[model samples]
Target: MSSHPTSPRPVADLFAADGRLVAIPRRPARREALLAHLAETLFASGRVYREAEVNEALKTVHEDYPALRRYLVVGGFLARTKDGAAYHRQRTAPLPGGATPSVA
Candidate 1:
């Protein structure tokens, strides 16, 4: 008998046929996973991005760039300047429910 641990849903499954995110998950765990995936794929480490650059990058994945941007910042996936003019991907980010993601 073999038992396997439950695996997280594939990040790709969250996207629609058009290659855009269908919807942002409401559940913290699921949402956090999605956000982390986005952060990894969308932005490069150690590179500062202008707000418009971030928006343009996010718009490729979802029509609701504003909400996605807010989530990324609020979820700690992306750090922003005080003026909200600059953004960059963080190496480690806090998940929802106050849990930090494990660094690999």
Candidate 2:
């Protein structure tokens, strides 16, 4: 699980009055968005990601990348060791129906 809950938007001020959540914002990232980021990061981080390396790489994006890591593992976007000492991006399979998405 992620140590920090993800917010789609930045939380400017928690409480301008009494430290209560007022005018709450919603910026929830879609599962795919997170997966994409992970994919890119994994690609750039060399083949295998050590636990600390993965954490440091993703710390800025999310409080902790574990939640995203778990999501990716479950979603088939990434593969991990049972102990999670390493991580890798799964070769992207074509989207269902196999018709190739248009880039234009």
Candidate 3:
């Protein structure tokens, strides 16, 4: 899927500089890349992330605002909540008999 959502521009096509990819100083597909990127960062913690905090952390890598928002919401890398956002960190397992899976 393209990062633009409305268009066909893939995030990989967005570049850092000529002949080299910076992965920061971002453009259209910036958010699309965030989930996987942050996962690599927060892997050891196994914790949830609020949207704003996530953006702040990502800033060290990319410098765009709108693209970051879109990536978090549209990319399904994180889930938004009334309090803020949580990184998608857990796997769902089937419940026994008729029970529903645990929710946080």
Compare the candidates by TM-score and give the number of the best one.
1
Which residue runs of candidate 3 sit more than 4 Å off their true CA positions? 1-35, 42-45, 83-103
lDDT of 1 by residue, 7-93 (tens): 878888899998899998898888899999999999998789999999999999988999999999999899888888888888774
The runs of at least 3 residues in candidate 2 whose Cα sits more than 4 Å from the true structure, single-residue gaps closed, are 1-29, 94-104
RMSD of each: 7.4, 11.0, 7.6
Which is the winner by lDDT between candidate 1 and candidate 3? 1
Q: What is the Å distance of residue 37 in model 3 from its true position?
A: 3.7
Clashing residue pairs, backbone N/CA/C < 3 A, model 1: none
Task: Work out the TM-score per prediction.
Answer: 0.80, 0.51, 0.43
Displacement of the residue 79 alpha carbon in candidate 2, Å = 0.7
Clash count in backbone of candidate 1? 0
| TM-score head-to-head 1 vs 3, winner | 1
How many clashes in each candidate?
A: 0, 1, 1
Q: Is candidate 2 or candidate 3 better by lDDT?
A: 2
Clashing pairs in 2: 8-27
Quantify all predictions' global Cα lDDT against the true fold: 0.87, 0.55, 0.50
